[model samples]
Target chain A: MDLTFTPDEQAFRDEVRTWLSENAPSEPLPSGDTADGFALHLEWERKLFDARWSVVSWPREYGGREATLMEWLIFEEEYWLAGAPNRVTQNGIFLLAPTVFEFGTAEQQDRILPRMAAAEELWCQGWSEPDAGSDLAAIKSRAERDDDAGGWRIYGQKTWTTRGAFCDKLFGLFRTDPDAERHRGMTYLLVDLDAEGVTVRGVDRLDGDEGFAEVFFDGAFVPDADVLGGVNQGWSVAMSTTGSERGLTLRSPGRFMATAHRLVDLHRRCREEAAPDLRDAVARAWIQAEAYRWYTFATVTRMVDGHQPGAESSLNKIFWSELDVDMHRTALDLLGSGAELDEGAEGATDAGLWMKGYQFALSGPIYAGTNEIQRNIAAERVLGLPRK
Target chain B: MRFAFDDDQIDLRDAVRGLLADTCPPETVRTAWSNSTGRSDAAWGALADMGVVSMALPVDAGGLGLGALDWVLVLEETGRVALPEPVVETAVVGAPLLHALGCDVPAPPASIATLLDSGASLYADTAECLVVLDGDALRMVDPSTARLTAEVSVDRSRRLFAVEMAAGAGTVVATGPQARDAVAAARDRGALAAAAQLIGLAERMLATTVEYVSVRHQFGKPVGAQQALKHKLADVAVAIEFARPLVYRAAWSLDAGDPDSAVHVSMAKSQASDAAELAARHALQCHGAIGYSYECDLHLFMKRAWCLARSWGDARSHRDRVAAAVVDA
Candidate 1:
């Protein structure tokens, strides 16, 4: 029942806080999904990688600090508090990396992790297709044996590939065994975006960022070395990644807590003119963040005690995704009509940060498996409800 | 940092849960509803025999001297059965208040009331020693010496009464700043107790509904197969999941005397209140007609949930308190 961090944990927190205070950029960078923004974010990622701060929980051989999960949480809190730029290589480092570590061979880990950590290569997720958005098992993407080339030739289209236009590679499910069942026979592969017959067309997102893309593959060649886990095992492997995406890795409490603090500060600044209702909303939003933080802590504690954290991540997804939306909504409401102004508009509040954030938070529920699907998963898996 | 109870605490909780399961079933609770004092004597006596009545009292007072963290789970089990007793008041808040007030009381339990908002106290009609918070003072009043009027509660098994204690009728156990702090702590414990109980009640409701939905058939299939109902109850389950940690954390915060313990309690109460109410709502909805009637066991837990959710600061009030703490720019 103890909540206080250990002395070593405190020391690590102090060290990171001091380093972040000195090294983190004073001004926020552009969105990492756009070309110019991606270029700037690449530099930030490089800076973090060089300092071994990008992925603190990974093994030291992979350019991480080999810190504990609690310390990793500490780093996130510091990173978000420092207002650090969003990780440009998050697709590789946060989501895919865990699966790779779990399923990848030593050869694959040695080849893939260091480069991804150092920003030498960037990756994007290619899960959602136009027809296979929520029903991911219905993926039509196919990769056939091209043993002559010692790899498979992939042919299909993946839509809503976030940051795909700028990424050099992608990791996704490919139908390898056509005879297998709906959830079987898929192969999780790391595909080179520069491979022949591969095309990435950037799609503009709500915040006017080309972070979304539709990737079309017409017999693109991927090496045999890129197959993650065994063939027909992609469903389980991809489930692990989605678990991370929907769980603690994709959205740590630190980010929301920082935003909540900002919301509180904003209310303080607007105290003279803020309505009582708005004040209450700001407070409510702040509690949601705090509650999520404690929820994560309790979860981490359980995992630390050696409990398998399946399905509960679905619970986390429902909570944080909605918390992000509600918190951002409260901020925009507090800002009133001025929230509509775009960035740099003369009358825009916080450089229209709340509006931009609101638009982005809108995607939280839609992406990483829609909250609807998550609720179903939670009901069936966590609550033992009937699937039918 | 360990965020879970140790083996001893778990053992204590399990023991309390088992004891209540034997001594305080719904039949006993129904019997208590018609009894004079509305107290389950056998259940209370068995619990006291287990030393739960004095578990939180100081060691010098011939008790276990446990903290709220240890008893948090026990209080939850009490709520699970909708235990027709003031275990929260008698043990959790009262023993601590009695200790703080330096009162030389008997080894038995007493119902303590601090809200004093509605001019009524729980179990005030027949409580021998009533710990009452009047203004800036904490008092140990004899309910028999004051004007007693019974107030019927929705959950009839647990009774309430309005007390008209004369000014300075009881011994002024503590006064000024000391009394203020103890009273505030007592109030926080009350809220935390309610929150833990609400969480337990929610779990009971969700389990009952889940069991009912699985067996009851409709439209040629089990009613639980409906996604609408599944998702509704899933949200209830999720609410309970999230609300529980807040209650546990609040218990820890109070046990450690954390400065923001009040805020933690508020968060717990707010979330737990919502979880229980949501659970009750979905349980009834999923149960269809049966849950509306008194025959269905779900109403027993739901009625207790309704009563607890509003007591010791409802969800809205607690959220406002949370807002004040976090939004005080």
Candidate 2:
């Protein structure tokens, strides 16, 4: 087995690197004082889409480069390394698009994909009800067929709907047969955000990033064509989409390396009176960052080799989430007494970006399935141990 | 970029597996550990005859000329059998370094090779060439060219040696910063090889534990059915799986002539070392008191894992090197 990129691949890398150097953002764009960062990120996404460099892994039929997995990984690495804005349409590009390509009807694909590619269609996940979190199979949201209406009426409460309040569309799951077994009755559907009887309420997080919300669907009508996969097959469709979210959202090692560089930058810009723990914390952060970089490289290599991500993806998730938390904690440790100050405090650099990152990291393991869940996955699936 | 072995590599790995299984039986390894030679010379010679020792040597040197990945393919088998011989020293270290040094390094025992510093110095009495360095001074000596001494080592599995060089007993193979660089590169390669073996040992240890837990009854149920112990086993499994790819990546990079091989080599080696030690320890814990006994055969893999983990370089040292390179990069 060889891990070295071919000369052609290296040339591709150079081209990507040069393009990013010229086009990527030099500073974070303003997102306004709101939960949705879509306004700023959507602009950045359009620039990438115009360049035809967005969604490298998608097939050529879907406005993608049709690149190899290795190339896709490299593109992401370079993109993040260039300090580009976070992907604003990832829910569409990474999750919904792939599912559509594999399982959605042609009509469905034709309708949603181009708008998604142009960043004109912002999407949000409508998974995880107040009662059903990790136990996703227990979703109680109801969707009933209406022959007269020529569509399904979705009546359910979906909580923890990330960015749902601002999204233009919702890709979610609901139980079509209440009497059926937990995993047997679910159906996946996509609904227009402006659909009647849909109410979105914000849930303010500790981090002050009000990105999550609860959505109550009262007789929300979704066209029959919006059903993803076959009727009872929604469970599997949801599973596939969830799997993509787990496996595809990882930031490449180069990005973490770039983050480490940022840490160095922060360290340098600090005043001489900065706490010494700040330096030590930065050093530790550097170590963890580099470690994750190597870890990511190894994982990417495995993925490029065509190994379907097994429980090992969970392991990567845990490592990265914990590392992110520790790194941000280190930032807080360095800020010392100043951490008590809110964002935009006088003399607070980058509006306390590190502190903001610290608070955001607290929700990482929780949102993308908890670390405990990941451990069980590793134990039960990867290790071939008997489930408890 | 493929991580799985091709057909030929799979065949070679299988052959190596058979050879190690036959030659380094637990009984045989323990016997050799207490023997005067502290190694199975017959087994070593047999391996050399079978091309294990000669696999990585250049085809022009009457050898197979296989690459670093091939060596990793075979080393995994070596760990499975807990072979007491220094195939790594003779095959990976001695042959390639000498090939690079442009010197015709002899076969082992006579070659007097130990890894950069994996195990205690073995066969000091008969070592014809001694490789050591201070700063940039690389001293290679024939026995008659240097004064030598021997020392008692705690690991009875291998003989230990000490030597004091005469004023001009050594000839510098390569000197100055370049030589240091070459040695550093060679040491990283050596560490990668050891890491591959550690992965093999960890795999075997986990396999053995799983098999035993499935059948061995405790409190009227199969031990594997227990959640507490299963979780521990799962932890070891995760560690092993995580380490394998890193080790494979390093070896593949080295084999493919990648410039970043050194950094990868250090990372893989450090992770593998930690995984192997954890796996071995957990295996013993799972095996209960019988695991402590020499008769159980688990100790064979455990001892090998323990030795290999600390050999070449320990985790902390490799981590420091990795840190320097990454920071500097």
Candidate 3:
């Protein structure tokens, strides 16, 4: 195996590194899930889209360079290392776009991707409902045929939608056939939050940011052209989206590598106060982060050879989710008494980023098919263990 | 960049693995513990015949001229079978020392008393020469001339011994800064080799555990059906999967002579050690009572994992090295 990158890939990395260093925002943008922060984040998104860095893996016709997966990973590494603003449009770029590229009609691709890439039409996923937290199939959201209008009328609520209060539209599943099985007869729909009879109520997260929204629908209309993968096939399509997003497809190791680097910096700063055990823990966290980078390289190697990542992605999710928690926890420990300080406190360190990240990482195990479900999938699917 | 083994490396690994499967099974390993000499002639001869004993040396030295990248997988195979042969000591650590020093060290069954990993050298009593890195100088002593005291290892297949030799010993083959650098690199090689082996040992143990849990019945169902147990095994699988790529990258780093090779090696060793230790702990736990018994084959792999997990810079030591490099740098 060749672990060294080719000269061409190296050149690509250098270019990304130089470009990000020069163009990335001088100051960190506010949390993108908040309304004002989202407006500022959209400005950053506009610049990225103008430079065609919005979606490096997509086709050039869609404002992308069509870079290889390896290049995509390099871009991610540079982006995170530069401390670039969060992509407020990730739900559209990462989650919805893959399925769109796979299942959207030519008209849909032409009309949707470009604007979405430009961040002109913000998008968020409408996956979770109050009743369907873990059992996503238990969603009771319904859609009815509106024959005269040539569209579908949607009904029900989607709660805990990240940045839903700020997003212009959404993509989620809605039951289209009442008589069909629980998993079947559902259709994946892209709906506009601004449409008539729709309500978006912002909810405060643990960090006190209104980063979540509960979208309520009463006869909100979505045209037939918005249906993805086809009617009654939402289960398989949604599964494919969530499966990859939970793995290396979305959460590139670059982000964690940056976090790990920051963690090392934190340790270096706190060396005097850090104990021998804390030093070891910091080293262990950094090592785990580096290990994850190599792990991703190996995985990307297989994928480049045309191998699909299957149940093994469950292994990936289980690993990085916990690694994220550990890395953040180690940082909090290094902060000691100072860690209790919230953001903007008189003497808060690292601007309370580690504390913010620790809170966010807590949700990592709970969201995207909780680690419990992911473990079960690993046992049943990868290990061939009996499913009870 | 490609991060996978090519066909040649994969073929070489599979070949050695197949040979060991036949020549060095659990019964053969058991024999090494009670045999007249700890050395396994059949396995060592077969490996030497295939050029594996000298794989890490230069081609001019009558060796395969392979780098850590090519030989690391084969070492992992040795770990898979828990082969009683001193492949790591002789091939990984010794052959290179001899080749670099330009010494005509006696044939295949050499041993080392290295400060890097071993306080006691393995197979030293049966070795033709017991080599030691005496600071900036490399020295070797005829095992017959040296006073060798046998030591009891938790894993009996590993025949460790304390070697005591006179000041001058037999010869000082190499000296000064070059020797010092070579020894340091050799230390990393030793640790990297152990890391690869730990991956193999963990995988084998996990596989055996998986097989046992799938079949062993309890409370009117297969014991593996329990969610709690399945999650534990799943975690073991996760740890092993993540640890392996680190071993591979570390081997690549060593072959490239990267400045960060030591850091990479430490990362690999720490992760692999944790993976193997986790496997050893949970494999026995999942297998229940029988796994602890001598009659069960799980102990054979489990005990080897226990010894090897800390053999080459236990997880904490390695992690501390990593911490110093990254934290201080």
Q: Count of backbone clashes for each model?
A: 0, 0, 0
Q: Per-residue lDDT tens digits of candidate 2, residues A175-235?
A: 9888898889889889887889888887866767667788999999998888999887889
Off by over 4 Å in 3: B39-41, B105-116
Cα lDDT of model 1 by residue, A23-64, tens digit = 988988877878998999999888988988988999999999
Q: Which residue pairs collide in model 1, if any? A: none
* TM-scores of the candidates, chain A only: 0.98, 0.91, 0.98
All candidates' chain B TM-scores are 0.96, 0.91, 0.95
**Best by the DockQ measure:** 3
Q: Candidate 3: TM-score?
A: 0.97
Go through the candidates in order and give each one's C-alpha lDDT: 0.86, 0.73, 0.87
Off by over 4 Å in 1: B110-118
lDDT of 3 by residue, A1-388 (tens): 7778889889989998888888999877888877898999999999999988999889999999989999999999999999998888988998899889988899999989999999999898998998998899899999999999998999999999999999999999999999998889899999999999789999999998899999999999999999998999999999889877887766788899999889988988998987768888888888888878988998888999999889889999888999999999999999998888887787988888889889988888887889998988898899888775
Better of 1 and 2 by TM-score: 1
Ranking by TM-score: 1, 3, 2
- TM-score of chain A as modeled in candidate 3: 0.98
lDDT for B174 in candidate 3 is: 78
Per-model DockQ: 0.71, 0.30, 0.79
